[model samples]
Target: MTTLIVLPLLWRTRAPFTSLLCITVAGFVYLATDGPGQPLPYSPLVAIFTVAAQGGLRQRRFAIGLGLPLIAVSVAIRTNTAREYLFAFFLFTMVYVLGVLARTRQAYTEAVELRAAELEKARQAEAERAVERERARIAREMHDILSHAVSLMIVQAEAGPLVVRSDPERAEAAFDAIAGAGRDAMVQLRRMLGVLKDEPSAAGEPSTSRSPQPTLAGLEDLVGEVRRTGLPVTLAVEGRPRPLAPDVQVTVYRVVQEALTNVLRHAGATTVSVRLTWTPDDRLTVSVENDAADVPGPRVRPGPDTGGGRGLVGIRERAAAHGGTAAAGPGPGGRGYRVAVDLPVVVSSPTEVRR
Candidate 1:
């Protein structure tokens, strides 16, 4: 009877329910036959523990139904004193509770591991999205810089030869404009590349020495550069001037830059107007409008080579990045084209406000 009860325990892990049933039946038979006494039923206790820890819900419930009666009978046959019976009962109950705790801990561990894996996956996805957004931003910046520069250069190059023989000074100025635009494009490209470089440059200086992003202060320089292309442009400001965050300034500058570039490439307008309005409601509105051309001159749509149709899209993206909105359509009275953006501004506290 002892051999039969003990031997079935080997199968506890692989077949916990069957092992428990065999051990329990042998224990009952051992008790009935008045088998040799033991301080405690070791095999039956181990089998019950294994079943509780490893068996499914229904299997564990069956073990519970069998365990109480087996413990009752074994204690009844082994001891008459209430103290001995209570002690035996306590041992069985403690072992069963320990098995239940082991099962709960294992389940909790698995659940925690699963949650950790899910969080890691979400983190990786967010990182990939951030990389994609950065790539798009860089592409937009490159397009704006090259498109504006190349457009100005093209206009100057086309007109330079026309006056080269008749007017030496005017032809020289146009050539100079072409050279200036090329040089400016190179400088801006270098600055952008510097930001991306991880190592020191050829001169041994770290590439972190890049220029700051363009802001409202550079608006005059930008307007003058385009004016050199023989296109008349004016700038106006309304309301109080105040400080703006660096990103907001960049958005404002890029919006105007793209708007002017589009005008030069496609509008054929004789004059352009750029206006900035700082409203009382803590908003900044940027407007770039070009008058209708008196006579249709050279005009080009953004073709495949010219990054066609992306200029307006880039403007809107820049505005949206700053929680702003962009609109482009015909100017007032449907005479010309206008690009406008509305941007929210951070209000300055009294202490931070300029006198």
Candidate 2:
């Protein structure tokens, strides 16, 4: 009766199967030598402590369950009477049950903590992606405003001397235009530098109302400035370019301007072509290709003082910021470098779409 009831408890308490077998062997020895009435009060207590130790270390419920009955059997053997044995068995079983319940509650708390840590990591990654998108939008805006101002300044600088001899009045007007362009460029440059230096979370005070946003509408003035540089640039529009976000328009214009600037400074090519196409699916493509210079020569290395090398890097950065991609390499026939950028058109709403 003792083995049948107590062994099952031992199994439940997750006692090592080998230790249970040894316990059985020891019980049989006591029965054979001193009979079933022999005192063994310590056996039940030992079993209880062993199971509690295993529960603390391994967090197994079975060890606690198996130890309970062994404790009862030990009390029954030591007390030497059925009435006292029953009383001790009841007392230990209640205590063992409470311990098991407490351990289970602790395990559940640990699992909840682990799950919370994982959720926090996921939330952080999402926030980083959002910040990257916003930074790119800001970069596109800065490029557009500054490039248009610089182009106009270049035009006014070239025209000021030509008109001075014929019409002094007009020449002074050109000089005034040059001064105004310089002030506008300085303001935009300061805004851009402030954004770069500010904390990531700080969206500083916005620029004042004086400097207007630049868009594709400003391309005419950009082409005129390139022409003033003595480079023949042909601008063509395949489809009616719809009104786009300030950032997108600026990105497209800068990509074309940077490519043409590269052609003028490095490529030494005569004729350049700039093409803009707007698709029905709200995508804009801009391409700039210049004719290859005669005679294949070794690649010219740009020095630290040169601005042409950094222009391409800046163009690529601008495109990437706007969720767009830019490619600039050798053109077809391996004759010249061609730069192209494809950007998605982002509009405000249904009303903006109709406009």
Among all candidates shown, the one with the greatest lDDT: 1
Question: On a 0 to 100 scale, what is the lDDT of residue 59 in model 1?
Answer: 92
Error of 1 at 233 (Å): 0.6
Encode model 1's per-residue lDDT on 126-151: one tens digit a residue.
99999999999999999889988988
Off by over 4 Å in 1: 36-40, 201-207, 294-305, 347-355
lDDT per residue for candidate 2 within 1-355, as digits (tens), equals 3454255344535654334445545664565465555445444444444444335454335444655565556556556687877776675565555655665776788899988988888889989988987776565555555555665565566667877999898778777877876786788776667556653433565544344445677777767656654467888887755767777776776777667656544535767888887789888788999876753222122346545355667777877777878888888898777899888877742212110
Candidate 2 yields a Cα-based lDDT of: 0.63
Candidate 1's TM-score reads 0.90
Each model's Cα RMSD? 3.1, 8.4
Q: Weakest 10 consecutive residues, lDDT, candidate 1?
A: 346-355
Model 2 residue runs over 4 Å out of place are 1-66, 74-97, 112-177, 193-213, 224-234, 240-247, 263-272, 280-282, 291-304, 320-324, 330-337, 344-355
Clashing pairs in 1: 302-308
Q: Name the top TM-score candidate.
A: 1
In Å, residue 165's CA in model 1 sits off its true spot by 2.0
